[model samples]
Target chain A: MRAHNLALVLDTVATSADPPSRASVAAATGLTRATVSALVDDLIAGGLLTELDPPPRTGAGRPAAGLALTSAGPAGLGCEINVDYLAACVVDLTGTVRQHLVEHADQRPAAAAAALAALGRLAARARLAAEADGLVMAGAALAVPGLVSAGTVLDAPNLGWRDVDASALLRGVPELADLPVVVDNEANLAALGELRVPGAEQTFLYVSGEIGIGAGLVIDGELYRGVRGWSGEIGHVTIYPDGRPCRCGATGCLEQYAGQEALAAGEPRAAAALGIALSAAVNLLDVPVVVLGGAYATYFDRLRDGIEAELRRRVLTAGLAPVTLRAARLGTNAAVRGAADAVVREVRDDPAAWLRRVG
Target chain B: MRAHNLALVLDTVATSADPPSRASVAAATGLTRATVSALVDDLIAGGLLTELDPPPRTGAGRPAAGLALTSAGPAGLGCEINVDYLAACVVDLTGTVRQHLVEHADQRPAAAAAALAALGRLAARARLAAEADGLVMAGAALAVPGLVSAGTVLDAPNLGWRDVDASALLRGVPELADLPVVVDNEANLAALGELRVPGAEQTFLYVSGEIGIGAGLVIDGELYRGVRGWSGEIGHVTIYPDGRPCRCGATGCLEQYAGQEALAAGEPRAAAALGIALSAAVNLLDVPVVVLGGAYATYFDRLRDGIEAELRRRVLTAGLAPVTLRAARLGTNAAVRGAADAVVREVRDDPAAWLRRVG
Candidate 1:
């Protein structure tokens, strides 16, 4: 009960638009002022929270000290392994990115071990930079463009990889071996990153367009990972059904028409195909918004009209509730940032665990 | 807390495979035997439960009496409005059907009021029959093949219903005015009905193939009703962009190829189109099972091969975790039974509410 109350108090302070005084948190959470103060003290002692300087007195005897998440305590290390790039970032407890690094390379030709080793080096650099800024690394998460489950990449056709043990590969790097790591699909992570946008909807589909198109389904503020963690394979959704054969042994998959290669080749039907596929998602899932990320964000100006035209015509609820479409605010950085945010969230969700570990 | 404990105890008995003794329920729920006995007594007095005769014992001094839900109280009234049929049924608390009636007629040309009036009369007959069987009508639920929200049928294309105030129409019928009613999409209700099947997967996509194609997504034992209750419009999912025009003002919709009319016309591409559209759903939603209901159940053997082939070929995780396909167990009766079941569930879930009302 104490742990739960501590987390509740911390979350209250973290999510408040303005720093909240202990009394305000007590009122908001329905906890007594004494209980709130005790919980806040524990959080402050654990370095999970800090009391902000009191505001200048206007007409009162003394202004209350506002509470906020500590920025200089713990941070998250995020790494990304894509077909063409490796990136890493460090995010602080206050949801601020402290360090970011991107390396442009054709990772498709590299072995899984080599790719992970490079990512390890980049993550090490980001970690050192964060440490220099008085932040300790809490944990790490890796984003891969593939079907990831239990720290293994089941398949990434674009990277010519399958069943790669990502955790073992990362463990080989001495700098990353001690850091706890979680692996997830890049699109899923990107969706989580977009979820942190100030005014984003709690439920929407986040489409990641790249060499292979993938999607992340955010339902009621949580990523819907599906039964086996292989949901949102929108790239493989049938578009033409017979127009073009796909490497996945499927005919006329959406990727064949609207993937990065197709869009680069200026495929005339890419926008229409995307619209058709998204319409199916919206109709079936009733997700009211679609966030276009990755290459789609880059080409949103060109694709928006064609996609909207098809959506208006194909969606059943268009007249009553139009599906909103928008570009990814974080653009190419969503996946890495989302990975870091996930680690930060883990610490915020269970500060007791972090406190116990540190103690 | 008492009401919650009452519902929990009732649900435990209701879902138990066999009638359980009060001692067994106490053990299962971690409540004291005295508490269980008191709750059971209240439930028995409220006509929600009954004590079964003890089984003959050889070694024991006394065999404990078993508890079961009462069959003679709080019956549910279910009605379905479809393009070709109007059906009503009464289901007792124990889930036994006491009465059922179906009228086959083309309802598209009839005004919504005329059609609902006929349904009200049918429901009244079923209710009277249930009353003769010693059951009291608790409430009613009506299922329609269209978009329903707030007791209004918004756009049932096959039935030519748009913005029809279903509650108002039913209220005009004195027989049903006094009964509490809920309006739901037929496919959603049918999926709920199928959820009651023993050993059924809690998450699956139920496709209802009538004159129009609608789908119900069940996730984690609950229906995934989208924002505004407009979800699972599988009929509008684009199949072959620009292939064929549809009455919903869309081109290449799955309904254009796999609807009941298309199958009746022996459309050669019906099976293939169904496979493609279902593949898209499986890919995006990652629902591991697909239950074909309505017309699709009748043609399951013919459509299974084509749909499975496409799912295996198109779904990204088909090799590792193949999507399972099955036919609806209840067949055409699923929607009406599900509607009735919904009402019965309401009573079972909150027996205290009913007891208060009756008192």
Candidate 2:
């Protein structure tokens, strides 16, 4: 009961636009004022929350003391293993990045073990930097471009790895060995990263462009990982029935059109194909919004016109809620940051569990 | 506390294949045996549960009496208003239909008030039958062939109704005035009906073919109602970008090829278009199963070959989990049954709320 109430209080504060007072938290969560005060005190003592001066008011009673999450609190560690680079990040409880590092090294040619070793080195640097800034690393997660289930990379044809245990790869790294480590699909993490934006849509599709395109679905503020945890395989959707051949042995797959390799070569057909495919996705899912991440974010201007033209033509319910396309706010760092955000989310979702461990 | 625990115990009993004993319920829910017994007693006293003979076991010291949901308890009322007819049904607590009635009348040409009046008459008959069978009518829900939100039919193009409050339409019917009523999309309810079958897939797409091809997406056992509660409008997807003009002002829409009218006319292109569209949905969502309902179920043998041929070629991860296509088990009654199930689901999800009212 205490844990549930504590999480309730924390979530109320995190969601408030203006820093919430104990009284407001109680009103929002339906907890008593005294209960809210106790939880707030415990949170402050744990360095997860801090008291702030209330903002100036227009006409009201004395402004109550404001409460906000602390930037120097327990942080989440995130690592990413992509085909072209390895990256790491640390995000504080307030969902702000404090430490980040990236190294461009093509992992496609390297052995799986070598790529894992390089990612571990990057994670150590981020952890050290976070510690120096008085932040406790709560947990770590790795994002990989593959189908991941139970912390194992089931298949990553892009990286030439199959049935590899990603979490086990970091067991020898001292900085990560004692920490709770998780592995997930990169597209899932990138979608989570996009959802971290304040006032984000409740349900939207996040498309992540790379050498191959991928998508992650966020429904009702939660990731919808399908059976076998391989739901968002949008790259293979047939965009053209009798068009170009694809690596997946299918003709005119979406990846062959909208993937980074196609876009990097500055093919106008790539943008046009992306628009047609996205229109189908928009029509089928009825999602009101779509966020473009990875390479798409860098070329939003070049791609938006084509996508909009197709959407205007194909989406049947566009008049109900015009499908809005937006660039990912966090840009290319969304996956690594989303990885860190995933760890912080654990503490936010069940503050009682974290409190129990601490107590 | 008692209400929460009671709900836990009742849910465990309802979901278990064999009626679970108090000890088994305690083990499954992490409640103490005493607490489970006390909650079970409350449920039994409320006429929501029954004590049953324990199943025979190979080795057991003392066989404990098992618990199961009472089939003659409160029943959920479901009413549906379609383009072609109106339907009403009552389902008992054990998910069995106790009373059902269907009226064959073309609603498209009728005035909204007259059609609603006819539906209320049907709902009255079903409620009377349920009460005669020693069952309490808990609540009623209306399913319409259009967009619905907040118990209002937002826009049902087939019926030419817009911005109509369905609950208000039933106010003149004394049998339903005081009873809580809900309105929803027929496709959403149909998908929920399909989910009621034993051993259903965790995540799959349910396609409802009628005048237009509608779809409902189920992910993690819940309907994926997208933003504005209009997620599965698969009918609008462009099947042949240049084939046929549709009412929605789009060319070669799936509805033009796969709607009931087209299929009734024996258009081979209808099955072919359905296959292509289903392929796109299956590939993009990575769902391993697809259940065909409405008109599609009647002609499954004709459509399956075309849909499967397309799936074999388009679904990229078909090798991971073979896509299984099947006819909806409940056939034409899925919508009405699902509407009733929706009402019962409220009780199953929150038995404590019902207990509070009863007490």
The candidate scoring highest on lDDT is: 1
| Candidate maximizing DockQ | 1
TM-score to true structure, per model: 0.95, 0.78
Tens digits of lDDT, candidate 2, A1-359: 98788888888888899898899898999888998899899988877788997668867688788899888878899999888889999999999899999999788998887888889888998999899999988899999988887988887867888888889886557777878899998889999998988888878899888877778888789887767678677777776667688766667788887888788888777776777677777767778888999888998889999888778877866766688899999898889999999999998888776666666
Candidate 1 local lDDT, A251-282, one digit each (tens): 89999999988999999999999999999988
lDDT of 1 by residue, B21-93 (tens): 9999999999999999999999988889999998999684898999999989888999998988899999888
In candidate 1 the C-alpha lDDT for residue B308 amounts to 90
Superposed on the true chain A, the predicted chain A of model 2 yields a TM-score of: 0.91
- Poorest 10 consecutive residues by lDDT, candidate 1 chain A: A167-176
TM-score of chain A of each: 0.95, 0.91
Candidate 2 — which pairs collide?
Answer: none
How is the predicted docking of candidate 2 categorized under the CAPRI scheme? acceptable
lDDT score of model 2? 0.84
Per-model DockQ = 0.81, 0.42
